[model samples]
Target: MASVLDAGPFFHGTVAALQAGDLLTAGYRSNYRPDIVMNHIYFTALVDGAGLAAELAAELVKGVAEPHVYEVEPTGPFENDPNVTDKKFPGNPTRSYRSVAPLRVVREIADWTRLTPEALQMWRERLSALSANPDARIIN
Candidate 1:
């Protein structure tokens, strides 16, 4: 089992509407790689970092779905998310982590910064290009 190494007011981002005490598990498909089913639930200590993830999750709906950030607690041990912690970076600078166990939602967060329309569009373009390229892979 992975050890929990950091203290956090952890958060998870997604388009799903969840209530407090709800559990988030793995096995979801990502817009970045719809062909793959993720094995771990991801979270970050940084609220805005989770905001970014929420935005990306909502981006798939092209303004139809609402992005949401939720304060969460891991139900079990977790480890640094290798998707961002390594590969090119040296440490867990993003405060990102992942686990096979469920994450319990504490509450909704409303104050995280939202990307401007232009910025969101720019990200959409980047993602489009990334999707076209076979090498732009999700580390999971």
Candidate 2:
């Protein structure tokens, strides 16, 4: 199975917040409408196949498989103010504004493909393979 080490820095923050039992809140700039600001406490991550399976198993055993997983593709670069100093806010010049492609939440793993066409084919294929792998343990 894969490990959490493979996830992005954002995933690391999410995992840390979950472990510390803290509310994860952040504001995100809108891509389509740059003037719009949105606040969110929930975020998703594209996890390594093996890592996800392992995490799902552990969480299910604990009765909390949370911070749901989803497949995402960034349509554009993450916009941020390059001049910022403080890494956390308005003081910090740079802020993660937004990405061109918005992330879609899928209830069933198979629904990942419905969000996009050929773009998500690779993720679907990988997930399908992982699901078929007998060695990958799924708690529920």
Candidate 3:
């Protein structure tokens, strides 16, 4: 069984959708499809923790202080196993987005594990360095 901590935080909204589409098509270099739902995005950065995840989500959508967050659990071996080869899509290229398992919302985000002030600051610095749009705000 996968623990709650194993799952990474995610954001579901218009901003996420756009970012997800960009990640799938541009980042992953996958073929675009009309059926793709471009309305939500998810991040699997366990190192950053939930607080950073929420902040990143909020940055995408202007005026939204706290976006709805969820935890995604891996259901099967294929999804649970780490990407050792660094392949964008494991089994089927067409089903790249299908790797994710079911998602459960975190009603009390404060109760869940969060990043410390120092950790958040470090992550912000690292993210800023890695971000393409340096001018864009990462945290709300």
What lDDT, from 0 to 1, does candidate 3 have?
0.35
C-alpha lDDT score of every prediction, in listed order: 0.88, 0.32, 0.35
lDDT tens string, model 1, 1-140? Answer: 54557899999999999999999999998755667789899999999989988998997776688999999999988888887787657888899999999999999999999999998889888878978999878877
Better of 1 and 3 by TM-score: 1
What TM-score would each prediction reach against the true structure?
A: 0.90, 0.22, 0.36
Best by lDDT: 1
Model 3 Cα lDDT, one tens digit per residue, 40-110 = 22334342333455555454444755543333333432232222113434543222122433333333333
Model 2 Cα lDDT, one tens digit per residue, 39-93: 4322234344313333333333344433233333232234332222243345532
Model 2 ranges with Cα > 4 A deviation: 1-66, 80-86, 89-97, 104-140
Of the two candidates 1 and 3, the one with more favorable lDDT, higher being better, is 1
